[model samples]
Target: MAQTAGVKPMAIAGRVASERERCIGMTDAERAWRKQWLKDQVLASNEPVHVEEYWRERTNPIRRIYRKPLDVLFTTLAPVLGQQRAADYRYITGKLGLIAVGVLAVHYYFKYQGNDWTKKGGWRMTRTKPMVLPGQPGFPYKSERCKDSDYADRGFSKSVFGSK
Candidate 1:
């Protein structure tokens, strides 16, 4: 190839030569860490077409937020469960864990959907749009806004307005 300084990256052909040499020089721990890190990055960067990406996208924010926790749980439990001998945790927590999450997500969706009396302006869940009026649902302020937009009145769009 066109390798220079014996270290500079070249096209696929020349780069592989240098990389193989470098890889052979690493310690066992370094090689293992590099390998595991690459796998983690791949899982984290699940492409749009991957099944994992499909569920993650369709799931709501509440369920989606638990991916890491489930990952940790499955990873930690896999070894204890005797299904996986490796420390990577993919054995017990990868697809099966995601499937469990999917089940929980569906359960949550229906559970709340059925009991959504609060959708009628009970607490934080409101189906109807907020009205834009004083002391209304979505009004900015109960009082008045400052003229300067720097002081503090009630609500003048921004708190920058000065209040009398």
Candidate 2:
């Protein structure tokens, strides 16, 4: 090859060394065969081939098969807790176990005692009686019945024993 103007000697020597190394491992006949094969490959193909097409032609069909559901689940759960970079599985499992134990403890406590001990003093239970509102057109304060009653005083008499 003719030397170009202003070309560095180190660059030219590196290129020559790389070329020599490439051919050095091959036998004379094997080198010739490789050269001819490469020439044929370059000259035979004029059509544009996509990257996907090239891989599909070269790769095994079974190897290309994908577990989509597993991949999606792994991707989703990886951030939460798994073999992912952020958190170790052992630590996460321990924390989850503690939480489970706490939940169970609370559940059993409530089941046995029927109330929470933590908030025992915070809350109180009280009974309330229903009030009778005045001027509702049902009964008078001191009278037996209202003026519209069909059976006078019988319906209002039941209120004394808290029957109605």
Candidate 3:
């Protein structure tokens, strides 16, 4: 590799180091082999390949990026908690746990005796009815239902309801 005429030695070395880091210590031969193998695999693959495939068109990147943080967290906690238990702990204490707490809160909110401003004084019961929203069309809340909704809306609703 010929260095530029005016480039400093340190700068050249840094550039070489950066390039080396890109290949993770693999030699020129090894990098060429890997590239050739990838080309062969792509050519041999039955399915057509898209060069500009998106995050939607490819899932591996999405999966890896999303799980990286959780993986680090679980590994960090695994020694103290045990691997299986660490994973379980993350599952139980993460979003799922928040969901459990939310459900419990809703349940207690509705079912608890004299909660929700009915018992403003906090310990005593009152027969106050649940407040109604302005848009509610009365007891059954007669509202227009959609026969067909947009795909994007459906996806948004799905994620909101906790499906991956």
Candidate 2 lDDT over 1-164, as tens digits, reads 44756665553223223566666586677667667755655643645544868877987776556433344555577766654532354445556867999999877765564422234432223334344478665434344335564332322444554355
Candidate 3 lDDT tens digits, 31-92: 67666755665554555654655745656777768667777888898999896799887777
Task: For candidate 2, report its TM-score.
Answer: 0.20
Off by over 4 Å in 1: 1-9, 12-89, 114-164
lDDT of 1 at 151: 39
Give the local distance difference test score of model 2: 0.53
Give a tens-digit lDDT track for model 1, residues 1-164: 34475677545422223576656686676667667755655533444354877787888888657666765666577767664453455545567867998999877766565333234432233244345777766567333324554333222433343333
Q: Over the full model, what C-alpha lDDT does candidate 3 score relative to the true structure?
A: 0.60
Candidate 2 worst ten-residue window by lDDT: 115-124
Off by over 4 Å in 3: 1-59, 97-164
Best by lDDT: 3
Q: TM-score per candidate, in order?
A: 0.22, 0.20, 0.24
Residue 63's lDDT in candidate 2: 50
User: How much is the lDDT of residue 42 in candidate 2?
Assistant: 67
Could you tell which candidate, 2 or 3, scores higher by TM-score? 3
